[model samples]
Every structure is written in C-alpha cells, then in structure tokens.
Target: MSESKSAKSGGTAGSRAGGTEGAATSARIGVLKTYKLFVGGKFPRSESGRVYEVTDSKGNWLANPPLASRKDARDAVVAARKAVGGWSGATAYNRGQILYRIAEMLEGRREQFIGEVAAGEGLSRAKAAGRVDAAVDRWVWYAGWADKIAQVAGGANPVAGPFFNLSSPEPTGVVAVLAPRRCSFLGLVSVLAPVIVTGNTAVLVPSEERPLPALSLSEVLATSDLPGGVVNVLSGRASELGTPLAAHQDVNAIDLAGAGPELARDLEIAAADNLKRVVRPAPDREPDWRGDPGTARMLPFLETKTVWHPVGS
Candidate 1:
C-alpha cells in the first residue's frame, strides 16, 4: 500500500510540472514594432538621427517617431520635385486608379488604423473606427474627382479672333502640406487627396503629436502604385518643417491648414519670398473637417492656363 501511494504522488507532481510548462509557453511576450519615416518610396531614418517619444492622448507612451529636421524637410522637397514630371504627366484616369487602390489598401488595414486613431485621439473604439471609415471614403471621393476635375474646371472660351481659345486647370507643381493637428487621419486625407489628385506631388508634414497613422499611411502609399516621391511624409514639429518648406524656392505652393495663427503669419511672409500660392486657414476657428469638403480646397493649388490655336492652321 505504501509503494502504491508513492507512485500516485510522483504521477501527480509530474502532471503539475507539465501544466506549469504549458502555461509558460502560452505567456510569451510579444515583439514590439518600430515605425520609420516614408521618403521617396522608401523607409528611412531621420537625417538628424533624432527621435521624440509620441504619447497617446492620456499621456501613455506609444512610440517614438523621428524628429524631422530642416535637412529632412529639404530632402523631402527634393523628392517631391523629382517626382513632379512623371506624376503630373500621367493620365488622369491612371491617377484615379492608383488613388482607388490606396482606398482598398486602407480598407484592408482598417482595424489597425482604428486602434491607432483611438489611442492617439483619445476616442472610443467605435468612434475611432468611424473616423477610419471616413478617411477611407475620402480617398475614394478624391479618386473619383481625378478624371472629372478637368471636365468641371476646364472648357472652351469664345473669342472674337479666328482662333480656338481653350482654358484648362493645371497643377501648381510641388506643394508643401501641413496636416491638421486635430482629426489627424481624416483631415490629412482631406488636404492631401486634393493636392495629389490634380497631378501635383506633395511634401507632407503630419501632425506632430499624432503621427503614427500618417506613418502607417506611407506604407499603404508605397504599395499603392504611386511613384517614388509623389508623396513624402516627414514626421516632426510642423513649425520646424513648415518654415523651410514655405520658403523653398522650388515649392510651388504652401498649404497652412495645420499652422497656428502666429506660425501661419510667419509662413505666409516666407511664402511671399517666392510668391508661393498660400492656402490660409480660417481666421476665427478651425474648420470642421466632417463637413462637406467643397472645391475650395482644390482651387488654390490649381492654376488656370489658356491655350490659343489658329482655327484654320
């Protein structure tokens, strides 16, 4: 009987050991993800080699995004300028296809964006999901505009002379965009979609505090058939990057939607050095991004060009 009891006790201890080992295997730690900047169709670390901690709305540590420097901003501008010719020359229908593909990719990664938006904006999961949907929809909306904008904005003009006078809108070349501080994702799509749909390349400065979503967006763009440097994202202080971009001699326009009152004034002054087209923010308050985005946002970055040809030539 004593021998039997000893065997049973040994079996019980072995069973407990197996259970402990299984628990340990199940409780393994997860690997963390390191985010990088998207530049010229590639992911690159900042030239400054500096990173700042990005926290959630509740002050919880999220991740460290690169602290973009003046050099980084200039590099982005170079990338944007390099891409201008090919991107602007592409047919509008092709541009629309690429933009729609971006929407499809964004929809595929909807859950991930929902989480990031929730954490960054301090919204509930449902609300964050809603914002993500809106952002995706915004891309589709802009894609549709790609082929139609020309029809709506351009036409034949009657002239007294025996010549055909045609007026059409053309891209204003490289544009420097400041992504809004609030509505990080939706506002970003709102401003950025308009610029690129018309065949203009952009050097975008995402929201300083909530840049994770924008960084993730770069991943989508890289795979969405967009040419290298068509959209370069630099994550850092807007004021730091916007100042250089506004004054950039090569940049064709400046969108100050994300700048504060004081910074906006300064950027406008700098933009004057090159007579860059400026999209000034509202004087009273931030415009509601959820409202219908009319053609107002797209008009500033477009220049009307008139072509005259002899009728009988």
Candidate 2:
C-alpha cells in the first residue's frame, strides 16, 4: 500500500513540473516574436514585401527577414529629410541631452547588444563587448559636442578686407553617408552624430556583411525622442543606392567610406553636378579606431564658410 501511494505522489509532482517548464518556454518564444523593422514610430515589414535570410555566427540561417530594397532605401531618405529641420532647429543644449540619453540606453542594454555583436560580427563575446563599450563612449563624447562644435571649428578669419566680420558654422541639410565595411555600429554612429548634432538630416548605409546593429540602432532612435526624418538607415547593397544618393540633387553632401576607385570617381562626378561638398575617403589605409574622436570624426562634418563682409573705410 505504501509503495502504491509513493508512486502516485511522484507522478503528481512530475506533472506540475512539466506544466511550469512549458509556461517558461512559451514566455521565451513570446519575446522572440516582437522584432520587426522600425519606421516612423511603428514597426513595419519591408514595404517591398521582400525578405532575405539572416544567419548567425554559427552559419545557422535565422528565419525569414525582410530584404530592404532600393524603394525601401528611398523611403528611408524621405523620412530623414522630413525630420531634418526640427531636430536641427532644436537648441544645441537639448540636442546634447538627447544624445546623452542614447548613451545611457546603450549602456543599459549592453549585454543584449554585446551578444548580438558577437553573433553578427563573428567576434568573441569579450571583444564584442569591448566594441560595444567603445561605441557607447563615442556617443557620450559627441553629446558634449552637440552644443560646442561651432566654437571649436569656427572662428574669425582675417580677410584682405573685413568689417567686424565673423564666420560661424551651420548645418548642411540632408546628408547621405556610407559607413565603413568594418567596425559596423561604431562607424555608423561616428558618421551620424556630427551631422545630426549640427542639425543636418542623414541617410546611412550600414556595412553589408553585418547589419543587425544598424537595425537595432534604428529602434533605439525611434524611442530617443529624435524627430523622424533626422536619421534614416538602409541595409542592402551599397552599390545599388550609392550613386542615387551621392548624385541626388536634393542631398547637400555625401560622406563616402568603404568603396573602390570606380565608385569613388562616380560619386565625385555626381557631387560636382550640384557642387555638393564631398568628404573624401581616408587614404588607402585602415582607420585608427582607437584614435581621438574629435579630429577624426567631427572634422568631416564641418564646413569652412567664409564670411565675406566688405572692409569699410
């Protein structure tokens, strides 16, 4: 009789444990279902109705994911152009605060992003975390510049003739940038912050091989109180969108990175049509990622506008 009671009690305990295990698994799956492309404060599928395969570092194909197309790229540009003014018009102090917010958010989510970088960049977890930390630090650095870039980069230039003249910086509206093929998110943020801090809009093309962080960044931007249209991101073949963006009459500047001579020449010609300012590539060599951010990152977004006031007697 005692053996029979013992068997019955054990079966009841096993059933309860199975029920709890099933509930925990369901919750995990629920979290995975929440991801999608971010656009205009909403999560959306690629309007092109196309999806491509995403893979993990282990070479395992992640499920169906939207392939952002040319049309989608253009759409992102439209959004960025729309947001340019208000974000740029904001007092530099407020802009700096918003940038600081992003850094805080990144730090809080460090572990999640670190793992993703490991899977996406094929970096070890420690290395990926190191890069992530650097990226977050980069944001904090730019946050300080949001209000002060003008004073640092601009000054009174003694001219052949001038009457109490001063030259100050201004934002160039609607910038298009191609991020470096390596150091994905760090490169993307480096290109972006200077432009936005100065009030220009941007459309960024992330590194082709690893794009997950760029998408994730879009999500962060969506929540960061940045106006829509200030920063647009597209992930696809850089060649496909490079010419259109660099040459587009509406865009004011093109920051080129990670391309060969053929593309470089093509963009140079396209930029000439409008006399748009083009930030040339660093000489055929690797970037010193560990170097200081000010000269390396901030200088590219600057323009030397000559204040031409006639010298009066």
Which candidate leads the pack in TM-score?
A: 1
Per-residue lDDT, model 2, residue 109, is 68
- lDDT for model 2 comes to 0.69
List per-prediction Cα lDDT, in the order shown. Answer: 0.86, 0.69
Clash count list over all predictions: 0, 2
Instruction: List runs of model 2 lying over 4 Å from the truth.
Output: 1-42, 63-65, 159-162, 304-313
What is the total number of backbone clashes in candidate 1? Answer: 0
List, residue by residue over 1-313, the lDDT tens digit for candidate 1: 4324322322111112233433454553333456778889999999999999887788867777889899998998899999999999999999999999999999997867776787788887788888889889988999999998887898899999999999999999999999898788998999999999999999999999989889989999999999999999999998999999999999999999899999999999999998999999778667878888978888888999999999996
lDDT of 2 by residue, 26-127 (tens): 442212322345544455777777656555556644334456676666676677667776876799899999889988888876765665566666777677
